[model samples]
Target: MIKSMTGYGVANVENDRYIISAEIKTLNSKFLDFNLRSPRQFSDREIEIRGLVSGVLERGKVNLNIEFTAKSSTNLPVSINQELFETYFDTYKSMASRVGVNDSSDLFRLAIQAPNVVTTVSDKSDDQDEWEAVKKVVMEATQKCDEFRKDEGDTLYHKFKENLDVISKGLDEIQKEEPKRKERIKNRITNNFKDWMEENSFDENRFEQELIYYFEKLDITEEIVRLSTHLKYFDKTMSSSQSQGKKLGFISQEIGREINTIGSKANDAAIQRHVIIMKDELEKIKEQALNII
Candidate 1:
């Protein structure tokens, strides 16, 4: 079955030390484009998270957000660099004195806001436990996202089937009109030739040869057959277990070629109408195929 590239899933998992929430949203894309937003403490695990995402989702524009909240202050992930803070405080105070500004109350605040004054602390055992919890939530969220894709895929499958049936019915109508269309073409050509022959002398043998070639050129049998085959192939590919979006896109192009050929060759208005309907359905199929995976 096919899967849609667009979906959303969120999972929250909590433990004694921390509460982790993972949200994943995906949109259609030619390749995997991953963006991550998470606490700085999890920076080390970005690559691993990306691998997990690629393994599960395969292809899409992916946005993943991980919210990590410590349950208690003791489980905090950051620490103050006291030495750096003191250095910045002294620098700010000295600069203030040089500028004849004796207000030192805000110097502590400014020092704390200085770069590198706050940093993430990596505790091996606690980090391992927290990472494990984060992984659990992320995996659960990914599973939910896959399930969402499956549901969307199911909807697309029915829509595709509906359009395919319409196109198929249109093809049948065209086929039914084929004989009458040919008869009309033959009569019209013969009548035109008669009118021309009365006006001027013409070579009979060359005229017959040209008429045969003209009829052959107007024959739409090969195009109709190829179109039918492509439709069936599309159905088969859509029913397969793996992702076939690109393959289906290629098949749609072939179908379009056949439809256009039929439209150009079909001289009858009735057949042309059917061809137009088929073209419309084909455009719908192509548009929806972009969202498939």
Candidate 2:
């Protein structure tokens, strides 16, 4: 199935002791680019979290943010920076004295509010239960992300089918014009040589051999056949239950090669117009395939 690399998913999980919120956002990338943000206490589990995300998301530029909040005061430990508080208090006291303020109560309040004056001490203890809870939240969020990718993939699938059909239709139009184009080429060549043959003696057998070789040089039959095969292969790959973004890209390149070959070799204005349309539709497919997985 086709899956888009760009998507967003979030999950919030809570219990009596903690509330955890996980948000994941992704964008198309050639390879996996994972970034994570979480509490300092969860630093030790970074590798595990990365592996979990990699397993689910596969390939993309992924940004994951985890917000962990303590629900119970007992679970959180608070600490006071006495030295920093003292420095702040003295500075505020000096400023107040210069302003002729007598109250020391305001100075204490200001000092307590200063940055790092009061902080929560991260619980570095290896708590298996908390890790399990966090893991659950992350997994749920990742699942939601995959679901989002699937939804986007469905939309892309329809879009790709539409463009492919248009290109196929254009190919059909070119096929319809092929007989007329060949007749025109033959007549034009015959007319141009009629005057020359009358003016100078030429070998009829040699002329026929050169004309056959020339026609072969201009033939696009092989290109058309190969392009049709590539199109079918692309459709089959899209239906497969695996990551095929890179494979789709490779197939598109092959399709382009055939399209270009036909455009250059066909040597007919009418067929060239159809080739242009097919090239345009193929470009659309290539652009969209970049975001597929």
Candidate 3:
């Protein structure tokens, strides 16, 4: 299935003690790139996060963030910065002794104000349980992210098919004019040399040779055949059950190659108009391809 490079997905996992929320957003990019943001405790799990995303998405500017919220204060991990506590305690003691005052080391207020004194580090990377909770949330979020892409991809597929039909209809119109176009070219050539025709004394043999030479040089049958073949391959690629954004891109380039050649060689105003139309439709498809995965 085709996937769009732009999408949004979010999932939240809740347990008795914690709630884990993860979100993944992306935009179009030429290569696979992933940025992950998670709780500091799970900072060591960045590699695992990357691997999780790589397994599903192949290309995009992907950003993943997971937030962990402790559901209950009791479940919140707490740690003490003993060094900071001791500093505050001794200072209070020194001032109290110098003033001949008593000190009871009531340093709860000092400890509470100290940085890192109360931290979640104990829960972030402690071991088995923390990672297990994190992994559950991440995988759930990844699944949601994949689902989002698929849903958006379906919309892209519809647009692509619509454009393909437009291109095909234009090709049909161009084909109808092909015969009339050749006749018009012949008339123009004959009119230019009318004064030198048999009635006025022209050489029939040379005229025939010139006509054949130009016909051989200006024929667009091969180009049309190749373009049609490429179009068929393009349609087939679109219908395939795999990621073919890059492949479709290459096929469209080949379509352009043939269309351009036909335009250059045909030279008639009518055929040129069709060529321009083909080009416009192809350009639309090209732009649409950038969004597909």
Q: Which candidate ranks first by TM-score, i.e. highest?
A: 1
User: How many Å off is the CA of 25 in candidate 2?
Assistant: 0.4
Q: Can you write out model 1's per-residue Cα lDDT over 94-205, one digit (the tens) per residue?
A: 9999999888889988999999999877743346778888888999999899899999999999999999999999999999999999999988878877877999998889
Candidate lDDT scores, in order, read 0.91, 0.91, 0.81
Residue 139 displacement (Å), model 2:
0.5
What global local distance difference test value does model 2 have? 0.91
Candidate 2 error regions (>4 Å):
74-122
Model 1 TM: 0.86
TM-score of each: 0.86, 0.85, 0.83
Local accuracy of candidate 2 as per-residue lDDT tens digits, 15-77: 888899999999999999999999988988899999999999999999999988887665438
**What order do you get sorting by TM-score, best first?**
1, 2, 3
Worst 10 residues of 2 by lDDT: 69-78
lDDT of 3 by residue, 1-293 (tens): 67788877787777797788888888888898899888887887799888877887778989999898776675435666778777877777777788786745455565457676666545446667867777777777777777888888888888777877776776777788889888998898888878667468657798799899999898888888888889889888888999788999999999989989988988878878878988998998899888878
